[model samples]
Target: MAGTGTRLTLLLFSALGFWTLWGFPGKNNLLHFLGELSEPGASIPGPTYYPMKQKFTGIAPLDKQLTTLVGFFYTAVDGNRIDISLSFLNLGSQVLAAWILITTESYRAGNKGSFIITSTTLFGLSVVIVGYACVAPIWFALHLWTSKVVSNPRDWNIILEQPIKLAIAPVATLIGFGIPSAVMTLPAPSVISFDTKLNWSALQQGWPIWIYLAQKSLESIATWFQPMVSMRTEKQKRAEMVKYMRRAYLFALGTSAGAHLLYSGLGLAAYFLPGALSTKLQVQLQPENFFIPPNPFSDEKATTLPNGALWFLQWDLVIGVLATMIWGIAVRLSENGKQDDLGAWIKALVEYGVIAAAVGPSGAAVVAVWRRDERALKAKEE
Candidate 1:
């Protein structure tokens, strides 16, 4: 059982790692190639395209020549590759943590059933989350909540509550899903600031802030539904369960906020520092900038705004780390009072963290493949 669990966990992490590398923004050389193809006469620019311009503009005053050199590297390497690589590293860390949790649970239960049950439950929840809630509007309330404007009466409360919950709910949602709601709505600026060019302010007087806050609120509600849908274990008392769940949700919110702050700080530094400083500072450095243009142009000249940097701050690095930690901590605590070997516990923590962080929109895909294989074998035997 231990061997099987370990193998399964490793396999999931491996698949997620591959997806992080290839499926994400940086490693996708094909996306650039395809974009160039789709828009003939338009060539894909590399990441240095912006820094080069900034260097020329005297915006990169310190180490101007170094900034050009850095930009040259970014243009050569695909930005998607950078995103994928960082995601893999972060996911790898998370997987290590999840392994710890699983091992601990196994030791405590004195059997593999608890481990299997927990895995299956998480798998099921991932399916609903990635498939129905994320991909499709199968849930009417969720669909209304995510829509640009809620037309349904049922969604009215969601719209109303979104403002109040913006700061808190996004943090909670990030904890549950590892994806911050803020990223989907916000315009990417360089890591240091958000692009206000097309922001709500451009549309009208108060539209941008209102829309941003509104979307955040909706995202929060959507996130809250995930745990409720995924939770399977029953509590001895319903009230106690509700109380505990609320507390857990709040804790996740706080942890996510802290993680966001950490990631944002790194991204901010990376986006703003002149070329020379990027070389000196490794923590804030992003490899994707080495290959892809900060903004590739097809029709209009690419805007000078720092969208890529903003996206990193809002979605990619910071949110990923927070989500991984939140889920890792939750899973670990769930095994409370379990007497498991330290190694096994460590292994479980690593496994779950990897699965959550690297998989992103594909967690359900992993679960489905596993289930299908199991069913096929079962049917053949029967």
Candidate 2:
């Protein structure tokens, strides 16, 4: 056996490998499925076959080339028009944009500290990709769940024997579990703004664009009210940034895992339910394999399930709102007299909500420092 450190490294690598290979259910295995297309007469599912190869063009030539190559490869593999797989095109464009911007920035910055820049860019991109991996599947699941395709009688099964109980039971159960989970994940004010008077350059260079934008918006709202939170020293700000980054990672893992768990449980239930589905409906619904269940060891023959991840996200969001309301009320209640710090909490909430709404709740908390500096400039002018 390898040493403890070696074993740990292997374990971590294995986990990451699994994630990269099968993270988002049907989504991640595109390459594997595409490989099957290399074989003669492999049948691809869902998309209708098209003889003409599809081409994808983007804002940049390189983007156009890359997407087109991808589109062509997809068409080759599936015998389907690339345009039919709009998700891949959209994802490719966004990823291409992010890479181009990051690479441009890195190149313009020069080789003096190229390693640091490269590392940061890679880490940032990884985070972005991971965020998308979790989000896209959940979104698709939700879209599928609500679509007219699922409106058929055989598509869904009632959990309880009694019709009325079955109708409301699952929803009630979702409400009971989902709301609290969502609330607990809500970004607190501490995670939002800390009063660092960071400039625009600092913000643009250090934080994600969504975080920077949300921070700017939140700062504007705060300026309309007045200063709310206590300022942090540069050292303290750096420390807080590191802390928030870690928190963001944890939040992403938790939310994604929770979402996958929900998918797996519901999927298994639908798959195992007796007499609730006809053979045609069972094949059509694919209740066992949806969202891929976070299992890395599963083979190509894994049972497919219907996408229902979005339903989980909706429940989580409901909890987030409830949690935010509770937090807001608690802040109000805790405010004692004329010197209350309610404004700080309110500003933080605004900042949190803006970021959470723009990105997911796993979004970063402290990117509004530049806006604090902006408010300072305006104050100077006044």
Candidate 3:
């Protein structure tokens, strides 16, 4: 049964990853009739060539409005804005699904810390899925390593909260380390040639790259420490792990939610003051500025997408991290003498629905495993 579940998960990962990469933006296989790319920078002469530019009704009102709005600004930007937005959404969903699926598998295997390692590793690898499919190998490596080590219940509680920390660490590193390093190291002008005549500013334009590099470097350092920390005896682990997990969940949640608001706030401000704010906004949406990591094996960075896609990125990070944090807090709070049977079930079910809906099959599987674990807990108590 476990083997079957693992195989099914592999299939899910392959299918979703392919659909996400192929169906979104540049390689839009699904809507091939709308626009066809004969090759990079080459298009077939046809009636509906690059229909992203054409006026058309979307399936729903919001969709139609969004489509129209995106098309209005698509040509002004360096890259295909609409395609980039949609691609990032697809990419985010792909990562969410993979995270939920792998975490569920780790939970099912009775290795609590394994999910943390697997999810973080997958998060890092998702950035490079464009160049190479390293998901399977990373999964196996983390899985094998984590499986050998059994965590105490107290330690498991601490490990569960670290994923939220892991998620935020990169963003923190970017702001704290990447930006300062880049500012010091980048050339005086900090501008690079985008096109024959166009200049792209590094600090102003390469925010995404800075964030990616910061996160990748920080994640490697953090992940290396996880095993060492996990392996420590109770005396060695007690003080630090307790201090860390107590605040990790809340701190991570606050940062994620705060970042979302900040991004949206800037967008709204930019809309009203385009002349005043347009240059600042332009820095974020600089064309062909997409980040390609230095190496395939150790790092991952999301596609260099348009500014409009920041909303999707915000939603994915905020919601995903928020959900995990809330779950951790609820469980921690319930660590009293008696279990709140109804409350636990209700929370678990709600999470299942949300994850399944937002993330898809993998989420549903995660919730299902949680439900099983809950029932077993109750049975043991009875």
Candidate 4:
């Protein structure tokens, strides 16, 4: 059954990732867009091609793509009101998902089994280049097969959430991911010059690089800052570690839930008080726009650069959410993984549907992880 689930997830994500990379964007669109930017001094085709709005700077294809990414990212914040909300939502969820899925907690004594991939750093460079839709599933599938991280007690026993990591996760998520995003969204000239915003947006594209650097740097800086303290015993240290893990979980819950409410409330406000809000703001805040995804089955291309930008990005968000939900439900840690499996899933699906609708996907994910952790802790205690 585990092998079957693993194979199915692999096939599903591979197909979806291919479609998302090529199907939605179309071959001509990709060629034409890249062709236009292939040269440093290319002519602007039109507004439709305006990543063409920000002229391509680099001569090489990879360099050109990286340069174009700066403007492409900026458009979500500065382009359409609707895309801003969706883009920000995805951005927030992406960071949270990285933390949840990867848990790149720093290496320390007593934390031997921790998953740390330094090549991408903690932030996921592949996620940067290939989109989260593609990278997350591959990562999740690797996790499903390589780590005995199911909901069973014996399986989870080896994967203890380290105390140092639990405390650091929140700090990493906030500073490493959160600060970069906030800077990218700041208003132009008044807050920062237009050029500065673009440059900052350029820097934002390399999140996988910077977040990991920041995390590791923080590890060193934190060592000095952490008050001179020591655990009394092995048992006391383990209990403290559990406490830190729970706090990390709470931090995730609060951040995700707060965002869900803030946006949902604004969306509702836009619905009721349409006259008070600008047309674009209204479009941005509409909850309906938040979850709509490109037709993954279709090869039709987006009409405009901004639409293409949205299309370029949205699948990762949508597919990432789907994959997480599957991981949460399928990787069972219930009291009876074999005996109560079916009932556990049915009940969890219902509960997740309710919570997800109310609080948003990230919020529901936090709840699921928290519950899973609690169950594992209880079983370990017993």
Best by TM-score: 4
After superposing candidate 1 on the true structure, give the runs of residues whose Cα lies further than 4 Å from its correct spot: 1-28, 31-239, 271-382
In candidate 2, what are the lDDT values of residues 1-382, reduced to their tens digit? 1123322332343344335433533453444443343345543232443222112223454333333223222332231221222222222223222222222222221212435433433444343333333332322222123322112111111011112211222233223323322332222223422111111111222234433344345545544664422254544433443343334334333343343334334345557873575554345335433322333344433221112122222222332222322222222222221113456556655765665444322221112221222233344346
What is candidate 1's lDDT per residue for 1-382, written digit by digit as tens? 1122322333344344333322442432433332332232432234422212222224444333323222222222233333333333333223223222222222221222333422422432432222111211112112122322212111111111212232333343333333222232233355322223122211222222333354456655656875443243332222332343234333433343333334334444566654534454443355354223332222222232223322322232333333333333322322231112556467645664554343421231222222322333344346
- Model 3 lowest lDDT segment of ten: 195-204
Clashing pairs in 2: 286-305, 289-304, 289-305, 290-305
Weakest lDDT window of 10 consecutive positions for candidate 1? 131-140
For model 2, state the Cα shift of residue 330 in Å.
32
| Highest lDDT model number | 4
For each candidate, the alpha-carbon lDDT, in order, equals: 0.31, 0.31, 0.36, 0.58
lDDT of 4 at 329: 52
Taking all chains together, each candidate's TM-score versus the true structure is: 0.25, 0.30, 0.37, 0.80
lDDT of 3: 0.36
Error of 2 at 306 (Å): 13
Off by over 4 Å in 2: 1-7, 10-45, 48-124, 127-212, 228-258, 277-281, 284-382
Q: How accurate is candidate 2 locally (lDDT)?
A: 0.31
* lDDT at position 67, candidate 2: 30
Q: Write the per-residue lDDT of candidate 4 for residues 7-75, one digit (tens) a residue.
A: 477559757876776566664264346444445664322332332324334555556766556655655
- Count of backbone clashes, every candidate in sequence: 55, 4, 2, 4
Scored against the true structure, residue 330 in model 2 reaches a CA lDDT of 25
Candidate 3 lDDT for residue 45: 22
Candidate 2, position 197, lDDT:
10
